[model samples]
Target: MPSRRSFLFAASAAVAAPSLPIEAQHSSGSGREMKQLPPAIAALTDRRSEAVPIKLGEREHRVERARGLLVKNRLDALVICTGTSLTYFTGLRWGQSERFFAWVLPAKGNPFVVCPVFEEGRVRERMEAKAATLPQASVTRVYTWNEDDSPYALLAKALKEAGIANGRVGVEERTQFAFADGIAHASPTLTVVSGTPVTAGCRAVKSTAELALMRLANDNTLKVYEAAWKSLEPGMTNRHVTDLIGVGYERTGFPGDASCQVAEYSALPHGSLHPQVIQEGQIILLDDGCVVEGYQSDISRSFVLGKASDKQKKVFDIVHKAQSAALAAGKAGTPCHAVDDAARKVISDAGFGPDYKYFTHRLGHGIGMDEHEWPYLVRGNSLPLESGMTFSDEPGIYIVGEFGIRLEDDWVVTPDGGDMFTPQSPSLEQPFSRA
Candidate 1:
């Protein structure tokens, strides 16, 4: 019987020989193969150079936390296939492709990655630098799959070479059923189980470093929101306003795929901003985000096109009250649902509880690496808010087809209290002139 350490050592040595795919090896072409080119990233303009840098230490902490959990679980290795988790651990910003490649992370050794040849250079140059600072050993091995050899075969071989046979092999929440089934069939001795909680628990809390990037992301989002507000016109269609917001994001050096959503009648919780032209008295809700580094910032702002109606003013006021109540109730050590209840109670007292429909989503979610992270603010989520944890303090009342009112701001639990990441606007009170 091989000791765990010896097993990995022996397998690593035995697998050192380079392996090529069958298609590449037995090409029937006229003695030459057509070479494929790497993907082209869109060229960035001069203005795009100002994109913010993400704090790597926070991400490193997230990875270390997960590694610690793996050790606690007595697992020999983890086969992380989830895109978000992969980025969190390796700092490699690759997306899911038909390629079926993966990163094999051993609990006590260097990480081994299997990817197409085209991606190896970027992954080593960029991601390897970040991985070097990981709490665990940062050595890495790379395997490139060719046309003949499937990436799945490479991954299974890599895992076995790492001595995972008859061992607990960790898999992600979104890992394909087909892939998992294939891996098990490849090695019947391997025991695969869900690694979601292990990953989620590791990423739940934000570190001080993560909070700093989140602050900057929120600030960037606010600037874009201000631009969107300035671009609004009485006759502009909803799509026009939305497109202008996208332009603002670009102007601010945000990534191309930055997320955005516009709501015309927030009172109708699901009301979407359509092609209708904005008139003098319509309310517009813009919920958007711009990517900074690898993290995301999600924020929402509401604006009045030209004037405000009496009904709109009352609705905005109630929504503002609910938002404030929730903020006040949010603090480190408080139950997650407390803030939700606090906001809901205020809306109920205003006689809009039944009409409100309990604020369409959770009070907020973690805001780093990915938009919706962990420690959600909803009924029955008892996780106590902790310092360094951030969430959106958005409270709203929707009445469907008529209008909706929502005031959203990002908040981080601090030693003193909740630190509001996004600043409130001076015009926040403008819509209340009808009172």
Candidate 2:
């Protein structure tokens, strides 16, 4: 049976694919008669150097932005317990395990880290490598705890030093509940609140630099998708198509963030457990992206193997119209959910479900350091679209036991309205054409 890749795995699967995923082994339909490309990336050469990511200055500015959010949210301090939030503010990359690894950022003073005593050197090395300043980034103070000791006590002590011992402390929302509970237990006098307002405030909006990276990432993903599409041949499994894209990304000098679904399995949005193979005239969906520096890209294009059927073209047109409507409605003043409403309107007018019955998901999601982030384009979210904000403009139509069509592009809100990082699909025949 084919397995559905979870979000984390789906987003970065291309980056870490040593080989085709387990889903590839289960086969379905036969492929079409077409020219075959090299199956392995070993024969291809990387095409370009990677672009630089969010720089030292940008990282520093992000911290200041986060501080402003802290004030607005009435948080005296914020506790970042690993993950993207830590990387976003401090430029430090670390994962959360059983051990306590956290950054305590006080609204009034310097930030401090509570780390393991045995792991100090490596952490310090990473801090030095990634820090915006000469000595450090926000991780200026380091407090250590031995395994025999309580790391939570050290973290609480840091908070006390920051004068937030008895005040409101914002906890990174993604932090494991058990870890948050442990911290609360250790710091009896502290009030813990959600840090999302602070985290999302700093992250949702894209910088010029981030947008450039995204532009490059999206452009390259389309190129990879086009290459994979052209290389399809009769008898090639879905795994074969996936490998072609993987090679295209490698040759393009970026870690791939993509995968493919063939035939009826294309009806499933993330993909289906049904082992489906490529065949002539079957709808094929290539959904993926690559990281340009720290920022990322997510673009999905669906097309046919042979000639597209009338139904295929109709569904594709509807979804494309929905995507275009959402893009056109995007502006600085539009509410996040308003975009979804706009897109949903197009699909509904075209005879789909009145609401989410056919569309199934939101219009799109905020896209930057993460594939799916804040300021989601869902119903009831009123976050105003901002000039620097970026999101995926993807709309899909799924029909049971048949096929699905989704055309995705990365887009950013402009001073006037919004613009795509790459053009939307021109047509199934010439999806990459500017013409």
Candidate 3:
């Protein structure tokens, strides 16, 4: 297997391999002034189809691993309701509805699904496609209920048949309250516990296959940021920048989500709902990401629309140092709070923060199948850092009514230390590193 640094160096070089122009000119064909900007980064994404993707076999391994956790914890089984957990373990993409739909995997027996009667065919079709992942010998057991019948009763019966009618059952952390109540009501003898030990246990550590998808996702996102920044025009509003971000991601072959904020608006972390137009020489903050397969990448890059002021330069450099500290501090066996502390100390020492007053949020969050997962880089977490955990190393300093500076990149925790998914921004002059 290739090292994360070498893999990223190769991936970055390949994605930006095309000699797409660094600068281009275009007009709206109406009365608007022609704008000169960088070339669309999407052109580099044409090679995305060549990337190897996650295979079905890896998902099978996840389920078997979860079973081991269940037995060790002494829980009867975990009821996987409609969500990413279901898909993560079973490769079944399901949506949540008022009606009951769940997967009952007994720690000691075969895994079975409880679904609506009418949707059984669709469920079976999905299950058959992921044939290698289904619990052994449970293909014939759909165990469904109708609108007039109780799905909970059906699930209860399945549990009884599996010889786990009376024992502790772990409920998904995100399972709706009604589902928990319904499960408890259906079977009076079962105790419920949080499945974080199992869910976060399996998800926080990225498999090689999982890391590959994330690598592609973050690489594509950085390229999109490059293209989006190049395509910027002085008159464009936050919404316009957001649209082009989508264009760049789609052209790169991934569906994406993004938001933009300018000038004073950037001082607010999530940005304002009101429209803010980009102005040349003012602060321009571009933060967005795209999803590669089921995995996700979240990156935020901040730079000025034109020449940055001296104050902007100082603040930008400070935030950059903060990000660097967190990255340097992350490694195997380090406490989660230590990463946040490292970043916070940098900002505080620089006189921009007394603590959380300006550097508002935690250092970063663990990223995976969902945008946010476990092992967060926040105070009080105390979880020891382990290899294969990934997080955003975003550090920022906000000056209300003046400006804000933030630089974000995804990082994978390695055996020796942490490795970034893309190169860090070296200065305000070359935010995208076009130079």
Candidate 4:
């Protein structure tokens, strides 16, 4: 297999990468202008199609991991109702309805699903299709319970039939709480253990296939950000700019959820998206991305509305350098916290250590079926960066009520090092200089 860095370099080379043209252009809505591109950073939009496919192997790998956990935990079977975990293990994408919702992956027997007949077609199309493609035997034994019947009864019957009559049963915290509670109530002998952590641990590590899809998702998001940046102005409302960003994601043929917040200074790092108006000399922070093929991308960036000050330029440089170093340090066999400290050190050394109050969030998180997954890059996480795992590398420096600067990128850890999924935007030197 090609190293992550070499793969990215080869991918970049194959695109006949064009020299990014960096210039400054004034917005017609306001006299404010911004940089066209940063030097040395090529736009990833050129090769979004090159992203790897999320294959059947990745799905099977997760199911096998769950089975391993079940045997080790001494559980007869595990019940999953969480949307992501259910989808990850059994390929069931049906939503929780007023009726019962669940699926069972037994330690020794076949996997089973409990859903309403109303969602039969959707379950087949979205969930069953995935199961059919896997190497595992067709394990989804559907139990169609009526909307009026007790969903817990149907689930318990299925579990009992599968030889799980009297042992520890695992349940997802989010979706299975009610149904699992009902099942445990019906069968007092069965122990209901929290299965959320087991599920998270199984899916947190990325398979090569999952990493490929994430790379594509993030690549498409890069274009969306560019379009949003171009359409932005001091006069545009936060809603309007965010809407435009959504359009960009859709226009590029990669669609998911796109959300954002734009604030002057009051809305510093990690500020909530609210009703606000942009103004001159203000900063714009965006937290947005799109989901593609069930996998999602979550990214954040900050820009200046009109002209920025020398202080802002220096801060931006430091944040960028820090994120770059963190990305460089991220690789298989390295501790997760070390990656975070690599970025934190750059920010602290820039003389903002005292002012930097909120730079302590995890530097990154796992990306797959869900936007926020596990194996977080935070203090004492200690999870080693494993090969084929993809994660975000975001580092920021923020003063709650004053101002903030953040830079984010996604990377896949290889046996040797990491590869950036979304390359940073070309330099903003011209924008900062003119501002």
Instruction: Give me the runs in candidate 3 sitting further than 4 Å from their true place.
Output: 1-38, 132-140
Q: Candidate 2 on 1-435: residue-level lDDT in tens?
A: 012233534443344334343223322353211233344333445545657656677777877888899999898888888877787777777866888888878898888888999989987898877755322454488899998988888888888887766878889888999878887788668877888899988888878887788888888777777766666675666656665676567667777745677777777788854445677788888888887776778888888766888988898899988998898889898899988998999999999887877788899999888778898989999988989899998898888678888888989997666799888887776677778
Write out the backbone clash pairs for model 1. Answer: 22-148, 23-148, 265-404, 266-404, 267-398, 267-399, 267-403, 267-404, 268-400
Query: Which is better, 2 or 4, measured by lDDT?
Result: 2
Which candidate number maximizes TM-score? Answer: 2
| TM-score of candidate 4 relative to the true fold | 0.77
CA displacement after TM-score superposition, residue 39 of candidate 3 (Å): 3.9
Tens-digit lDDT track for model 1 on 19-96? 121112223433312122111111212244445454456555666676788888876667766477777666665666
lDDT of 4 by residue, 129-224 (tens): 665644353656778877678777777788889887788888876654557668777676688887755786688777766776787788677666
Instruction: Give per-residue lDDT, candidate 1, residue 17.
Output: 33
Ranking by lDDT: 3, 2, 4, 1
- Runs in model 2 with CA error above 4 Å? 1-50, 132-139
TM-score of 3: 0.88
Which 10-residue span in candidate 2 carries the lowest summed lDDT? 25-34
- Best-matching candidate per lDDT: 3
Cα displacement (angstroms), candidate 3, residue 111, comes to: 0.7
Per-model TM-score on C-alpha atoms: 0.76, 0.89, 0.88, 0.77
Error of 1 at 155 (Å): 3.9
Give the C-alpha lDDT of model 2: 0.77
Steric clash count of candidate 3: 2
